[model samples]
Target: MTATRLASVVLVLLTLCSTAVPDVARAETWEAVISATSPDGLGTATVHYQHLAAGDSPTAEEINDHIDAEANRAVTQAMWDGSTRRPWTFDASGRLTTWAITVSEVFTGVYNTAEPHMPMNRLGSVVCDTRSGIIISWDNLFSDKTAGLTRLGEQLETQVAAVASPTELRTWRRSGQFAPVDVNFKYWIPTREGVALQIPEVQFGRGLKVVIVPWSAISDLIAPEFLPITG
Candidate 1:
């Protein structure tokens, strides 16, 4: 072995096979499922979600009994609930960068004794990045109080991220006609669970609206401890 010691033992066995390979076996994780199709599409329901940690916080009877058993098998009482939370950190190669989700909805309670219709509080926050689960940033806050009219809401919030893969666009304003609004979405990756967004068609000015959202339609009504950490 003398060609300069066999080229330094083949460069130390190629640096020990690139430091023993295995970065979580080339990482790409997903695990969560729930798919439902309706709005006059006959019927369909598939549920399988079990990934809740990151300081657990999913209650409201597990998102109102899975939205009252998928809205009473689509008969539709229209009751729903929400919650989801997880992912605080993991990036040094560990991946799974961020996640924070909060969703709430309480409908079917409307009274107008001249104008007293309330109840519909929504709060949603989503941040995802684990080698392309998509969703870079999203924030939504909606509150309503009647009897005199008081509705404060917020959404979209000028998001910017998503350089490629499927597609994701964001822009917002809309409150009281701030005007600007653009949210284009299309991203799907869930054989296991996490990342399935398709707006189909959503425009503001020209007014084309056809929205279809899955990923368990926002994680089976939220509150699965904010389920996030897909790396």
Candidate 2:
């Protein structure tokens, strides 16, 4: 073959090789579904959930049950508050706030376990290994537990300081201070740029408090199993 012809062939081969390589960011996906909905004056409750669509996943029944439990809790809380609210008059009726909780199955990645593995994400992820049926907790997602905890704590603190204003922080300190602890924050949601640390609103008597930080800030703490999605 001619020198130019050979160079062209080599270039074509390299292009093909690059194109064939799989991108982890592109490979991750989740199947979204409305697990439950109830409008019986319980603040118009609705729960949207997501799961793995690729592999053997937790059954629909299981997913629905999870959604139902979360939905019911919101409804019950609203009902209790409504009953206790003052001013029981015609003008004061139907003005109560509604409940709408949506769980995004953000970032689906599979990890090695006993048996079949599936996509697991934040919001509704238990990292439930469908085959072995074992729920992977937040602690398990890190290779070095102590180091991971420290890294996560720092990231969260920085995010809170950056997002929460001075007034908000002072108010929070009085009623709901953000405690830097390992177990205090749970269920992290992986997004395109970073992960959102999920802190229950029950602690602060408000909506969910999310602390998002860049992956680079805590990249060393994240396990290889989650790199595909978190990347």
Candidate 1 clash figure, as a count: 8
Which residue pairs does candidate 2 place in steric collision? none
Write out the backbone clash pairs for model 1: 31-193, 32-193, 83-222, 83-223, 84-223, 84-226, 85-225, 85-226
lDDT of each: 0.24, 0.39
RMSD of 1: 23.0
TM-score of each: 0.20, 0.45
Model 1, TM vs. native = 0.20
The lDDT of model 2 is 0.39
Residue-level lDDT tens digits of model 1 in 124-224: 11233323223333221111112101111112111112221223333323222212222333222222344332222123232222222334434433333
Off by over 4 Å in 2: 1-136, 163-183, 199-209
Give me the runs in candidate 1 sitting further than 4 Å from their true place: 1-30, 35-41, 46-50, 53-200, 205-231
lDDT score of residue 201 within candidate 1:
18
TM-score of 2: 0.45
Question: For residues 134-225, what per-residue lDDT tens digits would candidate 2 score against the true structure?
Answer: 33345665677667667776666566667778887676655534444544565555555666666654443344456776778777776776
* Whole-model alpha-carbon lDDT for candidate 1: 0.24
